[model samples]
Target: MNLLRERLTTPGDPGALRAEEGERPQSHARAYQSLKMQVHQLLLSRIDLEAMENLSDDHLREELGLMVERLLAEENLVVNASERRNLVRDIQHEMLGLGPLEPLLADASVSDILVNGPQQVYVERRGRLERTDVSFVDDDHLMKIIDKIVSRVGRRVDESCPMADARLPDGSRVNVIIPPLALDGPVMSIRRFAAVPLTMANLIDFHTLTAEMAEVLSALARAEVNLLISGGTGSGKTTLLNILSGYIDHAERIVTIEDAAELQLQQPHVVRLETRPPNIEGRGEITQRALVRNALRMRPDRIILGEVRGAEALDMLQAMNTGHEGSMTTIHANSPRDALSRLENMLAMGGMNLPTKVARHQISSAIGVIIQANRLTDGRRKITSIQEITGMEGDVITLQEIFSFRQTGVAEDGRVQGYFQASGVRPRFQERLRSRGIHVADHLFDPGRRME
Candidate 1:
């Protein structure tokens, strides 16, 4: 008799039966996977790809479902109606979607997907990493999925070029590294995009920043204050940038540049540009610096760079200095001061022969504010600091903190306990906001007020 049938029919020890019940789901999952693979192979051998190409999507799906049902019956598989339906869906996913990852991608709660290899998959849900039961048959199976992803976006990855960046049709960012570079096997990480992008009100609801801080940010954007958003990876830098960009005038011409197009701007007059990687021949490559120079020629009222990492920093700084008042960008840094330092380093990468004092002055004049976002130890993301650049004092760039989140301690449940507070010192940009008729109340900057 089969193990399941035997356990049900000959129940002797209650403790042993309880132990077996605990393992039933995993055993059933393995059986389902085995059945799915068998039926998938049979369906693939029977279907005519050339004939199916002419069919509409709905028609094709209907035909495939009939074929899958026929194949299961031919193989004498004894599955229930629900199991049969699932088997057909799995086959469809294998042929038409991302195979094993289709379900994870459909889940709105999953923010990130990390595939280490065929046997290991992890996902980030509610800011915490958890392992999932998803797996592929082997390394070759994983490689095929990777190839399908990159090819759809007109990108390639092989031994010669084992690293690639691409985005899904829904705009989720994907990074893949394989083989010699990835010692374990093919590895892929996906940063899922939200269907409905988070707004400033959403950030306040999540306690990422206070309502007062959001008011200041909204005023800065409306007043055309050049701002720099500084944060580390996965700290919601791009999300915050998107919210700030929403405040820009709808009539203004906005141009956005990024390695992969992730920003979801709402303005009608906005133009989005993305960088391109070199072909196998190592030719026909386009960099962000090239796009920035071209954006300036396009007569953009504001330039939004997705991130300033290398030589593009100099171009972006020059654009902001030369009439682009409300331009914005983000940089990966630990703090606001560190962000300025990174900009100085990137300027040197552009092969500029400017002195240290000259470089500092250029940065101080171009960037009016630096908003620092951070992902704390407990997996909570918050805007840690907002500092206004008040021009240069001697050789140093003067920065005054306007708002900050102060961490008191970890709670009993391990959540980061913190409060957002104003820094008392009024920002220099207030006058500029008033000049633009954007009034921010003085009470918003009171140091005594705390948001917990």
Candidate 2:
């Protein structure tokens, strides 16, 4: 142990690691294993693990310092002054943070973190993105960080497998690419999750949704009105859909299908299923379409698809049109009209040769309401339009907007000032509600109503 401490603390024979013949560096696996085992045994021999548990914080830390010192000296790991400082840093990395960027990523206010390479790191704070000086020593360090992240999720990343998508324990999404695959270097992108998933009330407080809109949407959800929430990427469509699904009766069975399982519904009768990516051997791939088909057989009263982006849109539409009238799904689009068009396009991806008119008819009958959420230039997510599909007129599907947000202008503070106004187009679904003995507010279309 003393010899190891001396060797580690002393100046290493700088040339000892170099081979005589100019060949590849020999593996240090055997030496490293021996060093680790000797240090661990020395630590156990001197410190009573059970006794330390009764010590207070300060006392425990004091005892730990003594234990570490003994472990370091007895192992004979003589680290020179320069190496000693680095050893301290390595210990800090394991005990405290992921170098300097861990604290920044852990900050609740930080929305996104980007690592262009080993040295360049950027973060998105508030609505503005800024570059940070946080960096790693090199690609080796960066790859270690990537391994640390993926290892926690039972994922693997290495030379043979250069790319992986994983989530942290807190559900923060992580994507990593290494070596030749990443052109630049090891790259990582993390999208942090909300500490506590937001509810409808929380969205109202955040100004993401007006109270009146929340009330109407909640009522619509409870009334079993099949809804399609549309938005661009990061426009909070799934978040809003999650809160809307929260309105379903707790007694009814709910089945949710997701690609990555981001929804956090709290109902007791909810069943959540996530799609699986293909294994390295090109087997065991379970897609969202498969999950949607499986959910249909689960005897679910309501089926919720996290997003309809591919051929799965056909199954989602069929589910809603057949018997699951209370089902909900999301699509990527800029507006309600575009959402229907996007649905038609995705339905085409299913390889069905249905006529365009028949496709529109199927969509018009399947989707009852379209709530288009827009991320304004100011980074505020607002329900820009609420349109009801009033069936087809001849060969064209008729869409009537009941409520819309018209921007007056940008405020002095750069925030957008918009008013939720009624389009004066009476909801065609009003008669359907009346037929079902469901009464809606008479003044729902009145422009005088304050959405607040």
Q: What are the lDDT scores of the predictions, listed in order?
A: 0.89, 0.76
Per model, how many backbone clashes are there?
0, 16
* Pairs clashing within candidate 1: none
Tens digit of per-residue lDDT, candidate 1, span 276-392: 999999998999999999998999999999999999999999999999999999999999999999999999999998999999999998999999999998887999999999988
Off by over 4 Å in 1: 1-34, 54-59
Q: What is the TM-score of each predicted model, taking all chains together?
A: 0.92, 0.78
> Candidate 2 at residue 21, lDDT?
36
Best candidate per lDDT, number?
Answer: 1
Q: For residues 1-452, could you state the per-residue lDDT of candidate 2 as single tens digits?
A: 12122233222443122223344235543343333334444444445556656667565544554555655664455646654444444334433346556667668988778898987899877656799867666787688778888777566787777878787666677888888888989999887777888788888787776776676787778878899999997788888898899888899999998766677788999898877766667678788999999998999999999889999989998999889978999899988888888888988999898999999999998989999988888877788888888899988889888888888888888988877877776677777666765677767777776563
For model 2, the superposed segments whose C-alpha errors exceed 4 Å read 1-101, 151-163, 178-181, 430-440, 449-452
| C-alpha RMSD by candidate, in order | 7.8, 7.3
